[model samples]
Target: MISAYACGPGDEPEAAAGWAFALAASTFCDVVVVTRRRFEGAISSALAARPELAQSLRVIYLDRHPALVALKRGQAGIYWYYVLWQRSLRRLVSRLHEQLPFDVVHHVTFANDWLPCGLVGATSAPLVWGPVGGASASPVRLARWLGVRGSITELVREAITRPLRRLWGDRAAREASVVVAQNHDVARRFAPVTAHAVVEANASILSDDLAAGAASSAAPNLVGPRRAVFVGRLISWKGARIAIAAMADLQDWTFDIYGEGYDRGYLERQVRRLGITDRVRFRGHRPRTEVLAALAEADALVFPSMHDQAGWVAAEASALGCPVVCLPFGGPPVLADVNAHVVSLERDLPAALARTVAALPRGRGERSHRWDAGRLPRFLEQTYDRACATSAVAEERPGRRRVPRPARAQRR
Candidate 1:
């Protein structure tokens, strides 16, 4: 059996369903998707809809809170402590091991470093590993900025955590039987450690219907004109305020902000203070289905998030034939061929908005094709098989490391 361990409550139902469907359709394995207590309802309903996965894959909820988890572990600095916890994630797996008979455990994020500690040095059932990567900054630089601590504190924290991360993380990842990476960018980062690193493209939806929608240039033609939509939380890193500020003069375009978080009150005040209240609106946390329908009708999706593993909103917009304007690096590189306008964060965003406004008249075609349900499932099937066969102890080649055997390709 194969089990999946995910951190936090994943709200991207389509994405999660795609993963579970892929595993169930192709392999003899059963998938157990684990998440925090908060996300159970959203994730469970999403998975239940999939006929193939309804019986095979199960959802497991944990009471693991990030802040509380950190405190209980007595970690000094939250960010560095996160890294250490990531290094020691094996404890989580041991708990998971008791619930299911799984030969492989796929931990969803790099934040859960505890995973490696469980399987690192052990010579037992093979472990397939993948760590989220390709962030805006180097990990070391990011650590320094997390707290207001002086250079000495930063140095002390780094001194302790960096070596431990290297020692523990390297052992777990390097020792893994296979590592599945989301992109070439992520794969290269882990190249030195795992010999059997394979790149897997995230699956998205693109179809004839979405293409037709783009061709029609059919955003909900509101009587007074529908405002530009921002579909994320109200946080400094999320760049909602930046978007609101940039749109002050685009009176013709209203801004509807969605999602709920601690930053809502602060952001609302920012909107009011800017005197763009009529132009900016907050819808606050709509259901996923409603959000998708809203995206289909919106003129554009704006997000200037400072750092994200991958901008999921970009993918959603592509699926709905909605154009996106974001800080250049916020979205994935694959969208370069389709409906994305990458902007530079360092310069004036107003200039970027002008360019985005200029491009709105021309509707971009949907970039993603409707995902064939069997596509990822088939790919994973072969990946699991080949990795299992090449169970030889991994060796490094001086130049380009040897490519593992290609899994049978699926025709899109």
Candidate 2:
């Protein structure tokens, strides 16, 4: 059984990752997916289209209070609501387990590590507690770019998480059979607490025609103005400013912003203030098809997000054979792989990214990104096997003591 509170119609990170894992696991065995009632329409629509999946997949939807649901619509206290919903799942999980014991209990969505996850404690079934993150944070020096409000927010979050990790993070990790961290920093944060932390990206190649795009855009000749795009919610921490700041120096490139948020004003101001008004275009949110097409044709994706747990855009861009210029921090470094030029935060970040963006076309031919079509299934298969094996060993040991798996954490 998997707890996927965010599973729904779109390819948002949590929803996509949760649905992807459930689909991948169904290829191996029957999958019991526990999600919110709100997604029933979309999920049912999808299953109706794929009859074969309906046979092996069982979905149980939990209803949330209307007040909480309404609050979530405006993006207020949603994670708090998620935590309450998760905490309430113990009874449901226990009842389900009593009727038919599950082989594994996986936590898929609300991937942040700081939150309380009741599913982890609800069953003795071997646990898979990620691919989760939230430990990654922006460097104080570089985060000054976020302005005073952003700076204080990060400072407060770091302060709060430190104690919270000690209080609960350690226990959660220690109990998890396999802690799948979304990034290396998150993995390292959980390492001392759990012996089974592994770094794996939560975002996979989810689009239908992405493989075709990946094959065709493997290498390209760049002869005209370079096109670099950023596709994400324009929030303060997303660091659209970093990309906008870099654009001033990148005369050969034209950056098209594909999403909008409150930060749109700040970012647009920066574009004008930089006097590169002609070079930058705030082409607000477009359809997914258009975004994918933009990625397929773009020279590079300049995504300089500060602490993104999993960058869906970076992974999609990379799979489309578009070079990614991202910071060495967060999920982009893991997902982009050889298809990217990771810009470090040490020197002038915008300048570093500018140089990387300028040189990306030449850099692509020097490296190869072997797109693994089977990466998701293969990962899910191994994770479940390892979870079962580890749980079996724990049951055999005195006091049901957890035993760490022999597999060392993957570095790449």
Candidate 3:
């Protein structure tokens, strides 16, 4: 059986849970989720969302001292705790290393790019990681296409960062026997260098049992008029604020802002100051299942994510037949082909939103439901089998040490 590790919240958990659910039900594999003390609740909460798959998951919550929890909760010292507090992490990794058995340690991170390859090097098992680093080719291309001439300084900065990005990937990716890229865009970046790099888009939604809750044949007409829903953290570059400002002139439309972050209070204040308090609603963080359900009920998923690579929300919404109003952030070339109403922040956002809203066809006809559990497991199983096969072949090769298959961690 293959073993995987899920660290932190966000897409990491979504991908991990989906893979685990698939692995458990179809392939003979198991997943153990490891998280800091504070995020233990998040793991349980994630598992509770899918009761059918809960039995297959084994959750391990590391309860360090209370001081660590407090430090993690506070925004100020998080960096210090994450990197500087090496002793704590070493103790935690040592303890986990001893307790759980992972043949292939998979760290599903926001940007697999940030971590050092040496991180899991201490372990005996081979590591398969990625979607690494948060980058989108679309946005950069979009930025260039717009002809907003970058100053010499900006060009110099890019030149410097370009090499650094490569170095970062080389250092982190060189250590992994297998590196998975969720989108073709990301896969292309590593295609030239890493022979092990594989493109594997998220295969989670195939198992969601949406058919059980059969609804009327009539289109899901959300009671509210021409509503746009944007789900994500309320941060500056996220471009949700741009969506809000864009919808400002559209008197008939309402924007429901879900999810929370450092800018919650600031965004709330901006909504009121802009006199859009009545038009824009801040429905701070909801459960992930509820969030998806809510997306299904909306007219369009308005995602103006500027910094993110592939907006999973867009994919989820699109899968549900919910049209997406997006500002291209790059990655996932599939979005261009999927049912999406494209917009750009580089251009006049408000005008673009106004045009998109006015031009939108009344309702989506027959779009696939965002997530279905059954198909995803089969896909993941194939990937796992392929990875194992590759390992076996490498073992057969002359002068190469074969990677051991992961041992299942005992359930807690």
Report lDDT (CA) for all predictions: 0.55, 0.78, 0.56
Candidate 3 residue runs with Cα over 4 Å from true position: 1-27, 30-70, 75-103, 109-111, 117-119, 123-126, 137-168, 201-219, 222-225, 248-252, 261-278, 284-293, 331-337, 344-346, 392-412
Which ranges of candidate 1 are over 4 A from the true structure?
Answer: 6-105, 109-117, 131-169, 182-185, 195-226, 249-251, 330-337, 370-374, 393-412
When sorted by TM-score, best at the front, the candidate numbers are 2, 3, 1
Q: Where does model 2 exceed 4 Å of error?
A: 71-73, 207-221, 362-373, 399-412
> lDDT tens string, model 1, 156-176?
644764565467656656766
Name the candidate that leads on lDDT.
Answer: 2
Query: TM-score for each prediction?
Result: 0.65, 0.90, 0.67
User: What digit string (tens of lDDT, one per residue) describes model 3 on residues 130-205?
Assistant: 5464333324433422222322323544565467557756655665667777656566666666668775544345
- Scored against the true structure, residue 150 in model 3 reaches a CA lDDT of 27
The local distance difference test score of model 1 is: 0.55
TM-score, model 3 to reference: 0.67
lDDT, model 1, position 195: 74
